[model samples]
Target: MSSSCPTNPSSSTTRPHTYNRKQKSLGLLCTKLGVERRRIYDIVNVLESIGVLARKAKNQYTWKGYAAIPGALHELKEEALREKLEGSQGVNAKVWDDEDDDETLSNSGSQNDKSIPNSDAPKSHKNDNRREKSLALLTQNFVKLFICSNMELISLDDAAKLLLGDAHSSSIMRTKVRRLYDIANVLSSMNLIEKTHTADTRKPAFRWLGLNENQSSNVINSRKRAFGTDISNIDFKRNKVGVFVNGEFSQKPMKQKELEHVSGLGQVDKSNLKHCTKQSSRSYQFGPFAPASVHKVGPSENNSVKQVHDWDSLATVHRPHYQNEALKELFSHYMEAWKSWYSEVAEKKPLHIL
Candidate 1:
C-alpha cells in the first residue's frame, strides 16, 4: 500500500536564552522514531515546504496534513507569478532566476533582522548564513521552480544551478544536489513528484505531479524496498546498529554510498560522462560526508555492482515499485556511486544517503 503525507519538525537554535533541547519536537520525535536528529530536520524542512506542517513557535509545529497542499501550492504559484511580474517591470525581483543565489538568499534571510535594532552583529551574521543555505528555504525555492515554470521534467544538476544561481562552486553545487535529493524523496512519498528520464540525454530527472494527480495502488514491492511494512516513508540508511551478517554486529552501518544517485549528473557534466571509462583515478576535493582514506583516488571498477549498460535500466531495476525518486537514487548509489564517487567525489558528492 502507498500513503501520501509526510511529517515535520520545527527548530530554532538561536533563541535569546537557554531552552530545553530534549523537549523540542525534533528531539522527542528522534527518541520516539529512533531516528537521528539530522533526519528529523530533513523531514521537517521538506514537510514544512509542502504545507504538511507549519512552524508554530520555537521547537513546535502544527500538523497541517495533505489537505493544506493545494492551498499552499496556490500561494506558491501566485508568489512565483508575482516575482515574474516584478521582474518584467524592472522591480528587481529577488526570488527567482537571480544571477547569484548566494546574494539572493543572504538578502532574503536578513529581511527579518533589519527590524531589530540591538541584535548581536555576529549572531545575526551567523543566523543569516545558516538560513541562506537551510533545507527549508531551498525546498521552497525548488517548489517555486516547478510552480512558476512550464517545464515538467527537471534534473537535479539543473536544479542546483538554478537554486545556486551564479554562486555555484563544486562544493556548493554538490550540497545543493544532495539537498534536492532529500526534498524529492519526501515529496515523492506524497506522490507530488515522479522520477523519470530525459529522452534526449536519457539522464534521470523528476516530473511534477503536484497534488492534483491521483495514483492509488496496493502494490508494494521493489527489489530494494518492501511494501510489507505499509509505511509511507522508507529508510535507506542502515540503523545505528552495526551490520553483522555472521559475526558480531561489528561491520560498520552499511559502508555504502554516502553520495547517492550521482550518475545522472555524470560527474556534474553530461559531456564528461564518457571520460568516466578513460579516467581510472582522479583527484577529489572531499565533501563534508566523504570518508577519510589515505588514497583518495582509486580504480573505477565497481566491486559488487550489477552490470547495467545504461542509466535507464539501472534506474528502473534497483528502485522501489513506486515512483519515489529518492529510493531509485539510493538503489543506484550502491551500483554507480562507485563509478562516479571517485570521479566526482570531491566537488559533487551528495551529503548523505537518502
Candidate 2:
C-alpha cells in the first residue's frame, strides 16, 4: 500500500502442505474465511494468481495450498526472462518497467535494475489496447517484478508504473496503484510479502518475503489470528449470512487488512445494537382497552412521561466507575441496554426497579 509498504527476501521455503486439500464452495469459503462473497474475489484472484488455488467450477475452487507457489513463482520468473529475451531480439512482448520511482532507490538497487529491462516498455505500448486490467494478471506481473529481480524494495507507485506498461494516464496509474494496495494487503497477510521502507530515501516500499518454510510447522493454519484485530463491520449490509464461526459471522476477513478498519465498539459487537435509537418515533397513542394497570394518557401526556425517563441522564447516574477499560465498556453497554429498554417500556407501562 502507498501509505505503508511491503518488504524483504525470503528464499522460496520448500515445505509440505499445511493440511489436507479440501475443495470448498464459495459460500463455505465465505464462512471459513470470515468475509462476504463479494470480497471473496480478492482472495480468489490473489490465490489463483499465485497458484495456491485452482477453479474447479463456477463458485468453487480446489485448494492447491502453498505447495503450488514455488512452482508458480518459478514459472513467473521464467516467463519474465523469456519476455526480456524476446524484447532484446526486437520481438514485441509485454514488459515490466522495473524502473524506480525515485533515483536514490534506483541507485541503491542498481544491479537488480540492470538484471531487469525497461527498454521494452516502449515496445509493449500496443498491448494496453489488447490487455485487460485483470487483477490476476497484474498480480502475476507484480510478483514477476520481485521474483525476476533482486531488488530489495519497491514502492507501490514504482510497482504500478512497472505493471502499467505504456499506459501512463493519471487515471490508469491511480487505478493500478489502488488494486496493487489490495493485492499487497492479501499477500502480506499470507506472509508472501512484507511491508517496509526503502533504505536510501526511507520511502514506503515492499520486499518479497516469498514463502516462509522455516516455521516449526510449515503449513497454513486458519484458526490463529492477531490480537486486537476486528473484522466485523456494522455499516455494509450483507445479503445472505449463510454460516458462522464462534457462533457469529466474523466482522472482518480472516486476514486483517489496514484498508478495512472495523474499529470502535458497535462495529465489532452488534449484540447491543438494539439499544441504538436512530429511528424517528411518533408519540404513543393509547387505546381505551389499554390495560387497567396502564393509565390511558394523551399524546402530550405520553410525551411528558417519555421526557421524564431521560435515558442518558438515568444511565449516567447508575453507571459504575471502573479503572479497567474493558470493564468500563461492558458496564457502559449494560447501561445503554438498560436505558433503551427503560425508555421503550416507560411508554407502555411504568417499571419498578428494585
Candidate 3:
C-alpha cells in the first residue's frame, strides 16, 4: 500500500462529478503541485499510515480503487468530516519558497555603482522570501485582469500583452510564456483554470474556471438576478440590414429598361414588378467602394506610450546583447568560449483592452 494523494471532500460535493479511476505518474503529479520528486515519495509514505489506500500504478502510486463509501447527506455536510486536500504533506515549504525567491534579492541590493547581480547568482533565504512575494503580486494582478476582462480566457499572445510590460527579447518572451503555461497547468490541475480550444483546434486557451456545480449555479443565479432589470431591444429593420446599395454594387446597377427588356415589360409591366420582394429597400446610385485598412504596430514599435514603457529596465541592463558595444563584445567572447545556455527574456507587449 502507498499513500493517498490529498482529496478535498468539499470538492467531491461541489466540484463537477466525474468517476475516473485514472492513474498518473508521481513525477507528473509533483510537477503539477510544484514539489520535488522526493517530497512526493514522502507523501506516499504518510498517506499509507492512514486508511486512505494507494498503490503503485506502473512506476507511480495512484489512488486505489474502492466503492463509494456509504454515508448520509448530513455526514457529507459536516465540515469536520471533509478531508484537507491542499494541506496534504503539511504545507510544502519549498514549493512556497521557490515561488518567492526573487523580490527578496532586489530589496537587499544597494544603489552602488556595481552592476546588479544576475538571477543565476546564489541568494540567502531572505532573498527567496522576497522573490515569492513578487511572484504573488504578479499572479494576483494576472488573476484580477482575467476576472474583470469579461473575456472567457485570453490567448497566449493576449496574456503576454497583459502582464509583461514592453521589454523585448525573443528568447525571454518564450520563457515568460512557458512560465505562464506552468502556472496555468498548476491551476488547471486544481480545477481552477478551465481550458478552451482555439479555432485552429490545436491551440488551447485557459479561462478562470467556474469549477463544479456550485460555481456554475452561482454564475447562473447572478445572471438571473440581473434579468429584466435593464432589458435592451433593437430596431431590426433599420439597424440590422447590411445591404450596400450605394457602394460598389450600384456602379453597374441593372437599369429599369434592361429589366423591362428581360421581362418583356412592354407586353406586361406587372411581370417585372412581381420579381421584387416586399422587404426590398429603394435603390440609389453611387460610385466605386474601397474599404479602408486598419494599421497595426508590430512588437518592435516601442514608442513611449502612457508610461514611457512599463517594465523593470534594471533586469535587462545586464543582458549579454544590451546596447553597450563593449559589454556585447565582452559577453560574446565568454559565451563563445563555453557553450552554455544564455536565455534572453522576451519583452512583453502593452495590454490589449478589447
Question: Model 3, 1-354: lDDT tens per residue?
Answer: 123444322232222332111223334433433445553332332222110112223232222100000011111111111211222233221122223333222222122101224442555456445433233233323343343334444555445444443342566567656655544533332233444544343345665542222333122122111111111121112111111110101111211123221211112112121111011101111111100000111111211111112111111222223222222222222211111100110112110100
C-alpha RMSD for every candidate: 18.9, 26.5, 30.1
Model 1 CA deviation exceeding 4 Å by range: 1-28, 88-128, 214-354
lDDT of each: 0.40, 0.39, 0.26
The list of candidate 3 runs beyond 4 A from truth reads 1-135, 200-202, 211-354
| Residues forming the 10-long window of minimal summed lDDT in candidate 3 | 285-294
Residue 8 error, candidate 2, Å: 45
Candidate 2 Cα deviation (angstroms), residue 140: 0.5
- Against the true structure, candidate 3 has what lDDT? 0.26
RMSD of 3: 30.1
The sequence of per-residue lDDT tens digits that candidate 2 reaches over residues 239-264 is: 21111111122233322234222111
